[model samples]
Target: MKQEYEALFTPWKIGNLEIKNRIVLAPMGGTCIFGWMEPGGSHFDKEAARLLLKIAKHDCGLIIPGIAPVKDMLGGKWLYQNKRKFAELAEFMDELHATGAKMFVQMTAGFGRSFALTAPLAMLAKNKALNTLAKPYIDAEYLTAAPSVLPNRWADDVTTRAITEKEIKDIIYAFGETARLCKEAGVDGVEVHAVHEGYLLDQFTLKYTNKRTDDYGGSFENRYRFAAEIVKEIKDKCGDDFPVSLRYSVRSMTKAFQYGAMPGEDFEEIGRDMEESERAAKFLQDAGYDMLNCDNGTYDAWYWAHPPQYMPQNCNLEDVEHIKKFVDIPVVCAGKMEPDVGAKAVKEGGIDAMAVGRQFLADPKWVSKIKKGREEEIRPCICCHSACFNLTKHNGTANDQDLTESAGMCKCAVNPRSMQSKKYRVKPTDKPKRVAIIGGGVGGMEAARILALRGHEAEIYEKTSELGGVFIAAAAPEFKEKDKQLIAWQKHQLKKLGVKIHYNYEVKPDSLPSADEYIIATGAEANRIPIPGAADYAMDATDYLLGRKQVGKDVVIIGGGLTGCEIALDLFRKGKNPQIVEMKDDLIAVKNMCLANTSYLRDCFKTNKVPVYLNAGVAEITDKSVKVNLKDGRTVELPADDVIMSVGYHPIPLLQAAKNVHLLGDCKKVGNIRSAIWGAWDIAMKI
Candidate 1:
């Protein structure tokens, strides 16, 4: 019987170029630092080129870069500053073109978040010349324009200056120059990234930010003029032969904002009410856009934009159909789009093409796996946002969890060798070694699974009753239940590879069996913070959220990292007034991994009036009250019936005694679950 997905596997074409299949690798940011610039621009690293070529050979018809900065001198908000010569970029472009896959570059203006990073870099350089007091002015000045004028809900009371007319002109010119460069680089096309609630484009589009009374503000047509002119300029520079794709979302994941400031009560409302979105699409298409990539949500409201499993897969296919009816040009749909779901969308004629993001991260050989009908073998994107989203947000670097540290290299979560496909194949080793893995946490489980797959007799000794380590903490949050699936999948894979697992067997380093080598996966320990009344009132958020213990009515949580935020949410779910106090100005530094959801969670907390005090320190703790030092250097007292300590966790250093031992997961370094698992996999593969 012919499969419904065969249509998706069939040959297709865009403009004069021909392609093999309908599956397209949506232009996604490959690395974190190049927020608005292509890695090909300045990061002319060999590994980046190799990664791109490997992705091209994966049977995907069209492959789009996450983004490429379209600037001349490279001075934009969050955009990447390219110092490398144009010749280097041209060489990378030639290699991608030779891979038999159509290539496009995603382009966007800088978002306010970019300033949060660039501000500090500039401040550091200035501080070396000046002093500490002068540093604040530089930081404040950058923030004033990047986020303050833009009005970000995530930013901590930072002020920004409104962009002047001269700055706007420079931006338009930058976009034009970038397009010209992309054309010179010999790329197939450029996708205008006016979505994902990132950069200058989305910031201008969201009405909540554009309150200025000028040509760039007021009505929908006026707000979209800058983008329209930029798209027009690109078309004029690249010519009609080069296909230009425009990626936009009708809803802002942030809450009330959407592309061009549209609002969506539900999915259907987003499509129906956003006349400006359709108008902008028509304007760009009329101006010469060949394709439209539609998705839902913005960054301010984040969760809706990068919709996870909590929302249905292919959640915005209907939005694509709505726009498809209005425009004659091809429509591309993205947002948690699965293989079968994408195939069905194409088969049913709901959309012309399918754009995938996290799926490619989960399995880069996604198109190849689908072409061969090995759907089950394709590792699905669990959407933990650890690798892609988190890294992009905080550090501005691509998640190299599974790949080597070489710059511009693309990596995956499940398959460590996905980006390094050319370097290593799933072939049996020359000589199989008997491996002993202690502790069934992420690191141990990963090592055991990979070693067994390499034809090694791998035996895992779990000290506790379960295999998962801090991954269990993922399920402790109100919206992180999906993480449990990933942990279960890892366990299932380990068992399928014929790994020997022994639970509740505590083995010290000396008591362990002798093998070729040993892997110590003994995870991390919780940091115990000293306070006056800690013993009676303080409990680790992990312990409280995991249902190991109950929290009190008026609870205060110290530390505002990802762990603390989740604990607060768990307390909120329990109908408690959660007060989170952090020494830092911002709540969580690792927010990129869980963008939209974080916005939603923050809003929920604020709406419920849950107190969140920043730049506050706990001066004293007692049974009846807790004293805090405010940013103004004043002390305030609040009742602390209960307290949760989320200060931070430390590695369990007892593993140092074991000879030829390796550490993985939070035990070695405090990081996401992907890091621990991938760390284990890498070490085991070499062993």
Candidate 2:
């Protein structure tokens, strides 16, 4: 290991529980032994256990699974009601200890208004009769309760009511019992699921979210009393020696209720600022919490808590380091933290430990890789929230993610076998054959790499001179460094696996290759609408992204989808005035787009004063101006120095007549990197 990284390998302590190293596998939803957000009885999640064990085997120092709710998501019973689950956890912990890793069960009070309200819950909330009938299984309204009445982040229509004092008391008692149960289960410690990310506990602590005259609201002490009581109660039940950590936010960085202050942007903090965080940090320690797993941002500023590639690396470090001075307890900083940066911070006593999240999903063996001085082999997490935690809101609907995607949270976009190990693991093929992949894009490359790993001779034929098809353009944005790195990693892996590459060579239907199997990953073509003067006045998204074309200062972008929004934001960042026109009610109208990602872009647009015209359509384009049909039935003429079209794409597959031919990626259908890569893995494994 590098000398700077040596600090991360050193032992650390939270109260009396000594961790093997300063590396903490930060909690993530669906990674807990207890079922997460699933409408089922609290029990040992074998799948979660399997995954956690795999990570543990990779030499992780400390493992904190996803925050397990005190109250069941489905059943009316509290977490303590499931006694058998504790026994199972004890057994899992015993084996986990054998791998030299200490485990902490992160227990949450609840999501409150922060709950990603799905379609079924929305139905239950609207239909009172159905809600009452479903009470034994799921309390829709109760599940959606907040510290005070507030607009739901997922949807404006559903405002969550205030959580009653009685309910708060019940949860406090539950935390105590939950800690006791965790101790009985031989877990190393318990971490409070948080006064962070604007969850139930955080809602009470933040003045903007909590508004009441009761003991749990109004004053700073009152606002924090709920969380304070939880740790105190846990200590009373589990003893002071029993370690208790708190998931904390060093800075909320919220400028408004649903607006985030982007990194390095000077703005008034609407939520908890640094001064308050300093006091709160000391106060939380005084309240009996042993450690602070720190980060910045709330649900309003979701990107900070769950940063995309756009956010800065070690984004929360400086703030977390500043907060560390206020408390003596170990402070771990999360949020796009770099290993070397974290090591330097730890070595200099800026922070005690490094808490990482999605990187573990991308590569569970990352810790082991670093330990073996094979850091380059560690698969990088691009921080795309596609397969994991796709809490999307669209068309005035809360939680627009599909039911299956919603159930399966904390997945990785690049690693298809992350959560589905049993189903997707590579096996030795009895028969090896030559495979032809007709595209050097991410999907085609992924297919080729996996096929080669499975003992097949895989060769990629690229029509272009380089690998990474549309992904090259997708990674063109300056903020997309991680995406570019991912492409580099894939290329490195393909070369390492000795996969043959045929560049600048396109295979046609008439010119057939003598391979056992063929995969067409020709990707997609930009969809063009029949608007007047489109050919003359507009630049396709692909052409612009590929740097083949440039736009003028005043740009009117057509479409408000992810691609269009991204283009607009990219252009705006580059000192171009880009206006968006969309027929949708919201910015990102598509489902399964994570709130963490979309919220950042939306907040960025708002913060930077980028003009967005929703519920509008482009009528026509001219040399001097672009005509837009506004929702109010007014035909407004926007200055048309340039027009960028990013409506969407259509599949373009080739060589489909071959007997063993297959299709994947955008060529199969318009989808994301998760779908494309996973599709490649699924088909490659079958062959």
Candidate 3:
């Protein structure tokens, strides 16, 4: 074996089991799941198995699946019922084992407070009428306790009912049963999904959400009982030698602390703070857990856990460092640990192992790339949270949205090979062809790279002196450095594939060059907003942002989409309080930014005293000032040194008369980073 690859290939032992490598595939779900007792009844879905198998083939040391319900049919749950199908699952597991990786099924309980009913469940215990109204929305057996008693935050009217002693016993039994099933299914190990703001276990574990008066609640000892009991059950049932890991969040920055919504005041729940994480971790280790999977945040107080693009990458590293003090067992750190950071974490003793969730989704070959000393080739996750958290709000189910739309499977911003693994693998053809891609942005770069990799002669023509197109301007805003990672990764891939690049060159329909095929990836430009005196005082957001033009002091930014909000923040950073006026009901309307990151940005605005006027439209612009119309039919005049317009962007003019030309990127439609990249991927695959 090559010396550079030795680090990843070395084996590491956990308890009695030895894993082939140091790489661990962080857990994630790509399809809807339920308990065995739900409406559809839990059955093995072959699609999920296939996806897992694909991940397994990547040859990571450990692979952890997302939450597998232990309570069977606990209402509206997507249960795992096909115990007999273990043989099929085992085939994938065996394949991974063959590759020197160990597969683990993650068992979870306590999803009662997931939906809106969690609020009502709490309200029901306080008042009966609210329970009756919430009953319609409640799903499954809430096990022994009601959703309200579950530790989480929701609208003021919602609350959870307390759990009885018998219910606690039932919860313990569920873990044991779930563990036994995994042991029989031939998994190398089992992981307890006691993290996040999920079902029963966490409901009782988190202090703010757990309000029990019994031995299971109130004090730290009482709270530790829930997770401890489950861990004991798994060890007892799975046998002492079985490798069992416990995943838990050390920090609970719930919404109550960040931005109290509905009926509560915004305040962090100090009860479940870092100190609590340390205590829980030690308790779990003592209870016979072979390892600790360190995770953070919850759905109720979503941001504290998920964070967002604005939050620094590796936000949870500090928490991991804190947990390491109390536990002697291996601590696996998760939450946006990229390749370099993860590799550094290993060297710095931040944790025993690094868990990658969104990073792997952006590129399944990440670990492989890092091991091969190809660090720059690793695709970076932008942490946009569009496909992960934001989409779930609209579809009601995370899996339904991810597999169908949100970059299916993996989440590379500029690569479409995510969930479409089996459907779209790289293949070679007998005959190669010549291809021309016009544009140097994400989409055009992706197309050109893919075409060249497939043994085709690919040439790229970018109209500007640079290649990134609007992305160069997009990265100009505050905290959008990760977006640059996407551009950098794409540019690297394009260069490695030997794709020819021609900058500052535009293509005309009338004057064209003959090739096997032409892909029009001409990106979009800032929309011309019509308002009097706009030209004199206003500057396009892209121009001012990309450094193509400069803005004077005390600026007014028009159009409150993602670009505008980001620009406003950047301006704020520069000591300028840019007022943003939007015609829409909300700011940053189009993008699915993470709630936690967005909350932090909102806090920044408040901190900096920057004004964001939603539902306010620009009426006209004067050289000295601008007039605006509020949604309430009120008009106001505001003085401004300059105006930055981010109303919208239109496709670059790709001579429509061009024949045998396929259009992609901003020119095809004004879409997101994923759309542009996937457009290129799809077009190149066909060519």
lDDT per residue as tens, model 2, 1-687: 677689999998888788899999999987877985566767788888888999999988999999788988877689998899899899898999999999999999988778788777877776789999999888988988998888877766778888888998999999999999999889999999898988889988888888888998889999999999999999999999999999998888998877899889999987899889989999999999999999989988999999987788989999999999999899999989888999999999999999998999999999888888987787888888898778887657888889888677877889977778888888879899899999999999999989988999999999989999999988899988888889998999998999999998989988967898988899999998999989898989888899898778999889888888889889988999999888888898888898889988888888888888889888889998889888899999988798889888999999563569889888888898998899999889988
Model 1 per-residue lDDT tens digits across residues 401-499: 222222323466555664445554555778888877878876788788778777888898887788786678666565564466667767778767778
Looking at model 1, residue 686 earns an lDDT score of 76
* Candidate lDDT (C-alpha), each: 0.64, 0.88, 0.67
Candidate 1, residue 237: how far the Cα is off, in Å? 4.1
Ranking by lDDT: 2, 3, 1
lDDT per residue for candidate 3 within 1-687, as digits (tens), equals 235345445566778888877678776644322213234445555555555556667767788866566644334332334465555566656665766668888876655455333222334545656545544444322432442354323234334456677866876787787677667768888887775544456767766667678788788778778777777888888888998888777766554533422112255564366667777788888888888887666654455455566656676777787788898888877776654566666666677777777676676676777666777877777777665444332111121232233323333454455645555556775679888787888788888877887888889888788888888888777677778877888888877787889887877877666687888887787788768889777888878877877777878989877778778878887887688888877565443444444555565565556887878978899887779999889998877888889888888757552555798977878887878877787788887
Q: What is the lDDT of candidate 3?
A: 0.67
Question: TM-score: which is higher, 1 or 3?
Answer: 3
Error of 1 at 639 (Å): 10
Which structure among the candidates has the greatest lDDT? 2
What does the lDDT read for residue 440 in candidate 1?
84
For every candidate in turn, the CA RMSD to the true structure comes to 6.5, 1.5, 5.1
The TM-score, computed over Cα atoms with residue i paired to residue i, of candidate 1 is 0.75
